[model samples]
Target chain A: MIDLQEMILEKDRLIPLLRKLKKESRLIAPVTNKHGDTLLSEINNIDRDTIDLDRQPQNSLKSFFLPQQEILAHYSVDTTGYNFTAPEAAKETIYFGVRSCDLTALLYMDLIFSKPAKDASYYDRRNRSVIITLGCNDPFANCFCEATNSGPYLDYGYDLQFIDLGSSYYVAAGRRKGADLLNKWDYFFRTVEEEDQKIRYQLFLEARGRFNRNIQVSHACHKLQEEEVAETIWEKLAGRCYDCGGCAYVCPTCTCFSVDDMAIDDSHGTRIRSWDACTSSGFTRMAGNHNPTDRTRHALKQRFLHKLKYDYQKHGKASCTGCGRCVDICFGGVDITTFIEMFTRDAS
Target chain B: MNTNFIPATAVIREIIRENDTISTFRLELINKRVPFSFRSGQFCMLSVPHCGEAAISISSAPNALPLFDLSIRNAGELTNAMHQMKAGEQVGIRGPFGTPFPMADFANSDMLFVAGGIGLAPLKSVIDHCLFQSGLEADAVANITLLYGSRSPSEVAFTTAISSWKEQGIDCRLTVDAGDDSWHANVGLVTELLQKELITKNTKSLICGPPVMIRFVIARLTEMGCASHDIFTTLERHMKCGMGTCGHCHLDGKLVCVDGPVFSLEQLQTMDVMELGT
Candidate 1:
């Protein structure tokens, strides 16, 4: 058993601890490119890589775990017989600067994939990885993580959590891996002084007040549970949505996928699983030309309800992390923030 | 890769031409050592290498071990490919997934089986199970009525089995929307047959068919003193992974693949929304 511990790391020792971690494990951290876009990617050269601690990355941590497409099995069919082979195991990696919202999204995803039936590939990848989350001091313009209770600051659900404390960093261990990380770099992390603890509390309060958006998502969540939102709101959102599925692709908790077999030769093939979205018409259409949720309005309603109401009822929490990526990436402005406003606008 | 998404190989033992558009493929697992079993109303993801996969309901009862049946209609790309394939051909199968019809709960109750067109495919397994595999003498149960309907006389499926069904003490009643030169049975909608029969207090209706027919049958049943919970039906949705991981078959809070292809009217009533051919 590991006890929760908090420590202080001086600004000058930060790079040294990261350099030490890079020696044993593949490192994935937030970095800003020449285009000024922040992304979470694998970094080999720790000295040259510009790790961005200030901004949330352009994508969630799910892509590194559950990729866009992956081979489930390889198959060969001939006149005599057929055979199947499962894919090889994944590598060990540590995600270094995950945001609180994205970390919360991962927690929700873990529950979904593991429940009812164990998702072998997802669990395999998830088990081999470690996550280090960074609390938000400066939220983005569209962020509403506070409304969803998924961040500004997350007290649990990561291997390690980092909070900026002016000249040094305040680090807390959330899991055994985090404790191990602190022990590995004992020379860098000093015992948490009283002053450091005071600053940590002050900074957390400051971060909570810094959020730009104040959307009341929980209010909408309750309203959605009681009754349906007006059909006109769905129609309006559907009119703008091109069914591009960008929102789901950017959503860390949306884990829907499709599987298919691609033949390499007459006797050989590979079964592939790829990301899929409910926004598409083909998602619910049966082979017999029957579609229960045929209209775009119904599809849009299904998506939002799943995020806001249905998941909450099933899992005891809403699946949306309010990461604001859907707002940033969606061309149609059909983000969760917009839906919440519309849903609660007429609530009694 | 996930093993749940990987399909096992199954060979087509035989094919029964049910109609112009539908065929029943009798399939057996290539590796007989891998024991597979399924109850009525469950479905599987059938795959044709290089083509794709579709969720096809099982048409054979669970007692028919070592071999199962999938009644498919040549409606889409993957299914059309399935229809073109011949016996001894190999295909990928991943399942025995989804909720099965509540056989134990409805065992002592009177069963009213309603099927329309190819909808009879899934219900056929339940009929076979109750009539043949229930370990009870024929007519030992309270009641068993089968009211099946098709577009026309020529389009009817399982024509040869209707007489055998009658011999087995199953009250098999057939209807068609239109009549032909050689036709001499009930000539009207399947719901019209309901008026000629008596519904008992403990009758459990097992219905499957076109959305329109199901909607009307449900409405008629509800009007005639049947509780919403006693009326059961199967819902069809697009599916990739038959397990709950895939979101294609999700309907609000329910993942149709796992939560149901089989649902009671009471269960649907509690859902956020479900299409009823409106």
Candidate 2:
């Protein structure tokens, strides 16, 4: 095996490096809030002890890629006439301390925007940025990344991955860009020996054991295709759903959006695109009285089945990562774990 | 400042008043030297300055001379403003957005067109294309029928053009919801006209109307031996933007703006149909 590249930084040196990076680029890191939950925020300075490596961040990484509100196109109407204009360009960003699960989520978003009909705006932000992931040293109670075939360490989709090793960090370069960043500052990192690799492996194994939740839906895409599964079960599962669209809002994979044209004046207007959720009642309401999926139960059923069944059939992977954000965020506490357990047993 | 949202200037060349509340405007792009191509059954987002925008389908054939036609029902703010305009007035047009009707799929098949009220606006594009003898073989127009219904004779759209097609020996059936003393056509809901056995087992049906009419017509067509794949319908939703970015027009995972405003019954079967405000 190749010798792992390692970096040794004194607590004082690490703080200074984070501060220096902040000056040159937009740097985001996980910081613990008053409630003890970790959230990714803009960091001007770093406290090594301030990093919370346990549990997924409260928010998904999608906000960095697809903002909540973006100007899609602009329209201006004047006595002379109306004109259409595209939105302004985006800025470069560096997302630091992202979790492996969230990084995997970004990779899935790449597939969505890079499809045959490409979304240029999404592609613009994604391609220009740098992603730095932090390995999870301790798994949370709700995390089921193991079940989703993702984990604590960056298997893929990160520029650089930092493994927390008590006094120092074991930095592994996952991409050429990451390697170049290290090479440019070669004075900071020292070569890691064979013995250091054993300790890192041990930590990974212990971290795996700490995770309480394990999902087992290996062939989720294939299982949902069985015609024998009755539609009545969806009705039963949907009974408890409130149709508030909270699950979609918190989901890392849900990418639905809506566009609106705001008339600024007679000659000028702005057409804005904002995130939309399928769980809302107005999602399918047509003009002059037509709505195909008008019922709350039906909308709820479609939201879950689309993520679990339909998207998998089309994209070759389930859209859900078993992050349990939807479960925790829901007002009704409608846990997806319960549904998965019930659906698997019923299908068998 | 971006130019992407700016609509091209198109002048109204002619206006055909369909009813007291509805009219079809024939618009010519000011720069007629450039070709503006759009398929039949595709809708455009029309904008009237100071009023707002509305999704309106192209009502004329692709090869129609001089100007393209937009049939507007003066119910909304944009359409109400549009009704006041006359020839030489300029309006903004965006799109030719959404998926158009699958013309190639209907080749060599016996076709049936069912329309009710203003739902005929979008279907008129298909009707014009099929009736035109330019590119299509003479045999392709055979075995076609149009079943049109309105509340009254006064509410019927494209009356002059439809009568001309009827005079040209096209099989056209007209009906009214409540007929007057002068009315000679079948009188009832548009679905009642289906009882006349105008369609055969081999006919492919296309239905467009209000939701209530579409649902009733679909049930009647199904009863008349129309298979799910052979039946197609157009849907209209609150489309704030013509792009799929807007979530308003979504029906399940499908975006009506992108996946379709037009879909076959086979595609609709996968969707969940529910009552409004439930």
Q: lDDT of all the models against the reference?
A: 0.85, 0.73
Model 1 interface CAPRI class: medium
Instruction: Encode model 1's per-residue lDDT on B18-116: one tens digit a residue.
Output: 889889999998763367888899998887867768888999888786789999888888888888999999887888899999887876788999999
**Candidate 2, TM-score vs. the true structure?**
0.87
Please list, in the order the candidates appear, how each scores on TM-score for chain B only: 0.94, 0.93
- Locate the minimum summed-lDDT window of 10 residues in model 1 chain A: A287-296
Residues A1-348 of candidate 2 have per-residue lDDT tens digits of 323345544344556666666676777777777688787776644654376555568888877777788776676655655555568776667777888888888888887665434576787777778787888888767888777766767676678888877766677877776666667666666667676677779999998888787665555546667643456655665676777778887788788776556677556767665677877777765544455663644546666666677777777777777667886877765656656666667744
